[model samples]
Each structure stands twice: as structure tokens, then as C-alpha cells.
Target: MSFEDEWAECQKTANQRSTRMQLNQTPDGNYRPGRAPGGDLVVHDNELGAIGNEAYGLYQHLRTQGDEARPATFAAATAMTSSSLSLGSALYQVHDNWSTQLGSLKEACAHISNHLDYSQKRHKEDEARIATGMHTVSKLYDYFK
Candidate 1:
């Protein structure tokens, strides 16, 4: 399959995983091993944060490349409207998805803040890490072949 197909498949896998995680239920009505019935707050937080970060990085990459008319990558780009508005709309969808996911990330960050005793320095460091992660994501996509 092509890159876009692979990407969509990856998304579907993630969605399936997330849904399974969210809908977990034990017949005994008690927490399960490794995963709390309510879900391990830390693990859930981490998963949400990670998914948010990925979506953000994806949005950035799509915004950077989507309007560049990359027929070399996505064949669908060929029939796409040449209008900036159309491209912008697609890019905006990515942005909007990222924005929605960002809430979950912020909650995860808040958990970190609580554990870290509200250290501004640590929070700033985490922000830097996020920026660096976002940059690395672009490189990763290209490097993955």
C-alpha cells in the first residue's frame, strides 16, 4: 500500500486500540490486572498525551506539505481543487483534530505538573521536548521509507 494508505491503517489501528481500552469491562466488576477498571490514570493519561502529540505533529506535517501539491506522494492530490481554500480546508481539518486532542494532552500535562510539584522549569522543559518531538516526527516520516 501507499503512504497514505499505510497512514490511514495506522490510524485505524490506534482507534481500535483506544476503543478497546476505553470499553474494557471485567465480569467481576472489579479492576483488572495491569489496567484499572476505571483505567490506569497514568497510562490513560500517557496514551491520550501521546495520541495528542502525534495528531499535532501530523497536523503540522500536513499543513507544511499538503498545499505543496505533492502528487509524488498522494495520488489523490492530482484531482484536488487548485483553490487555496480547498487545501486550506483540508489543512484546517488536521488543525481542528489536533486542537481537540490537545485537551487530553493538557490534562496529561496537568498530571505531570501535579506530580512534579508545579515546577515551571519542568513544564518549560516538557514544552521544549514537545517542540523537539514535533520536529523529529517530520524527519521520521521521511526516514521510515
Candidate 2:
């Protein structure tokens, strides 16, 4: 096909894709009620706290158990290296990679716990701010009475 034909076909495909209704959007391009203005983002405080606690527990477990093999693995690597065995290099590399991966996992667990905790605190602060604003507005109206 000519370049112009290909361009026209591409344009038609793009238009069709853009006009398709997405999961949270309606045919008229507005977000569905439960996902937008009228939606409730109700998160149970206890549930969020539980999740954060679970993440912290997992982090603690991994820190100890995951490193339980560290001494053995390093000892084996050192023995192999001192024996001038070709396997020494491979063992060391494995040890290094494993350490890196374990560190990443620990970091991820900690991040999850911290993020959840911060979210809970932020949500409570936002609620408090809104409540205070509403109370102030109510008092202003009463003063005018």
C-alpha cells in the first residue's frame, strides 16, 4: 500500500482505540460514578494497619532467616578460593548476587511497611483537617444567627 493509505489506516485505528470505553470511563468520556466524584475510597483503618504490621513482621522474619545462610555460604566460598579451585570464582559470584537480591527484598519489605504507615497517618490528618474546616464554617454561620 501507498504511504498515504498506510497513514489513513493508522489514523482510523488510533481513532477507534481512542473512542473505545475504558474500564473506569463511560462512552461519553466521563468517569463512572463509583470511580470518580461520587466514589468512596473507604479504607478500613484496622485493615490498613494490619497490612502495615504484616509487612513489618515479614521484614523482621526475612532479616534473620534470609541471612541465616550467609556465614555458611561465605565460608564455603572462602574455602574454595583458598584451595585455588575454579569453582571459587563461581561461588563468590553466587554469594555476591544472592546478597544483592536479599538486600533488595529487605528494602522492598521495609518500603511497603513505611508507605502503608505513612498513608494511614496522612489519611487521618486529612480527615482531621476537613473536620476542623467544617466546624469553623458551622461556627461562622452560628455567629451570624
How many clashes in each structure?
A: 0, 0
* Tens digit per residue, CA lDDT, model 2, 58-83: 99999989888878888998999999
In model 1, the Cα lDDT at residue 87 comes to: 67
Scanning candidate 2 in windows of ten residues, the lowest lDDT window is 18-27
TM-scores for every candidate against the unseen true structure: 0.23, 0.66
At residue 15, candidate 1 shows an lDDT of: 60
Model 2 residue runs over 4 Å out of place are: 1-37, 138-145
RMSD of 1: 27.1
Instruction: For residues 1-145, write the lDDT of model 1, one tens digit per residue.
Output: 9999999999888766522222233644454434645643223445545655565555556556544544332443333434433665565555556555655565554555455443444555665685577558746755763
Candidate that would win on lDDT: 2
